[model samples]
Target chain A: MTTRAKQFISADQLLEHWQGHRNLTRRVIEVFPDKELFEFSVQGMRPFSTMVVELISIAGPALKGIVEQQITEFSEEVFQPKTKEEILARWDAETEVINHYFNQISEEKFQETFNLFGQYEFPVYQNILYFIDNEIHHRAQAYTYLRSLGIVPPFFWERF
Target chain B: MTTRAKQFISADQLLEHWQGHRNLTRRVIEVFPDKELFEFSVQGMRPFSTMVVELISIAGPALKGIVEQQITEFSEEVFQPKTKEEILARWDAETEVINHYFNQISEEKFQETFNLFGQYEFPVYQNILYFIDNEIHHRAQAYTYLRSLGIVPPFFWERF
Candidate 1:
């Protein structure tokens, strides 16, 4: 793919897209009852809070790594939230961290390959897309968990 | 959002990104045993087959509506696939259909507002995105179902 020659998305639009999904995910986090958020899982899927840690850990760190041109080991251990409020607080703080680093990325840099968490080697944009994609994937689980508990999720289309 | 002034994603990349998700969903559909695919549910969530029908009915039809500039009522009733093979067949055909109409949309048109199925009015690109996003949403339920059934799902990152 001629990454340098072709631009499909702008830095701003990409960030907005990522953040919109993040916004919806925040709603998912908000709606979860305190107990279920930390403990609920379908069969063997991770609890929404565990999933939230995985989501919280990625984008900001990955974007920071991309901007710094450094490969760091991925860790969710640093954030072990005991409550829903703790998870949401970290989520908000991480949003700022994401915006700070995300804005630093040049469009051309998006095409450059980065070994994310020193594991998955992909173009920077793909890695960023993974961050967004992974969140959506996990949030989908939380939605099912919510539904099985008889709660309606915020609409998927209402990203903003 | 200066939709015309700034191009964030090219048509090809957007379509490819979408198809990758579809490919993953296809694999998810493939892994389910016939009965579980048709009958299993977590609480009262729709069965995987029903979810697949909702998926099968979108994208191709939505793209067709966008290309034709006609708002048609959305329906999954037209494709009540009784077997896994039928779902896969329709899925493959719809993929081709999606490609055919998706390529017809010029970049400028991505920003145009269209009332999808006379229900959700959104930018054409967002509508297309909804198709991909909704698939992921439903597929997550299928994943939970698979795990509940003691089956391992395909890796989420291996979209291709």
Candidate 2:
């Protein structure tokens, strides 16, 4: 028979999803040529490169704050000019940090609620969703940017 | 013949992931008992309900702003205390709005970037990630809440 139905979630699985989603985001960045990454814009919006910088920023100190119960200590990352390669490099770095932190979570910690920026309170799982949801929100913008360029970014439907 | 193997990316696949991911976050709220939804917290945090309100406020207003290309005037969707049911209703509403706006994206519009909060220059794709990332971040906190209650959430592996 299949393994027991594990209704209880695992930090590993959450981390996996985190990794995969980041993969998708990075690929989307890759699909865009260097010119498109920095120059293209829909409605005079921020460039893709700027968006990637913001992405790099979410996990490093942000996750730490939620875990330790303090504000992120730095400004919410704002996008600025950066090379595509630089964006990708930071993406990889942030992924590593997030994975390392998530791996540290034990089952007991899952149910505990914590302060997110001294504002909202939620369980660790809910916080995980916040991270993912926020990324998807931003990714949606990327999808729009990709399509507007007539270069289809990867699919939004694949969960696996 | 199929095109080059570019990360095996598919927009449809990403959406599937997005939908599943969203459902995961929405479901966590349902699993949470009403009492804990409002008052519980770990290490002096707010409440799970508080985070949900923040979500409803951010996702809807952010999307509205992006699609309409003007800073949105938001209501107290995320401010003040909200019942679990109210949060659920808002969740449903945001989903509908996001899907509807996404449908309007055309190939030509991908290149047009909309200003996000007048703070940073981000491509449309980056903006979308903002939403996803925000959600996941919060969801992680929920996981902690569920675990602290000795309640195991759905297997995180299934999140994708």
Q: How much is the lDDT of residue B89 in candidate 2?
A: 81
Query: Positional deviation of B158 in candidate 2, in angstroms?
Result: 3.8
Instruction: Tell me, by lDDT, which candidate is best.
Output: 1
What's model 1's overall lDDT? Answer: 0.84
DockQ of each: 0.54, 0.04
Q: What is the C-alpha lDDT profile of model 2 across A48-114, one tens digit per residue?
A: 6775666666666667665565665344345454577777777877877887676665554655687
Model 1, A68-154: lDDT tens per residue?
A: 999999998898889888988998999899999988887667767889899989888778877887888889888889889999988
- The Cα error of candidate 2 at residue B152, in Å, is 1.4
Mind sharing the TM-score for model 1?
A: 0.93
Report model 1's chain A TM-score: 0.95
Model 1, residue B85: C-alpha shift (Å) = 0.9
Where in model 2 is the C-alpha error above 4 Å?
Answer: A1-160, B1-10, B73-81, B108-111
Which number leads on DockQ?
Answer: 1
lDDT, residue B90, model 2: 72
**Candidate 2 chain B, which ten residues in sequence have the lowest lDDT sum?**
B1-10
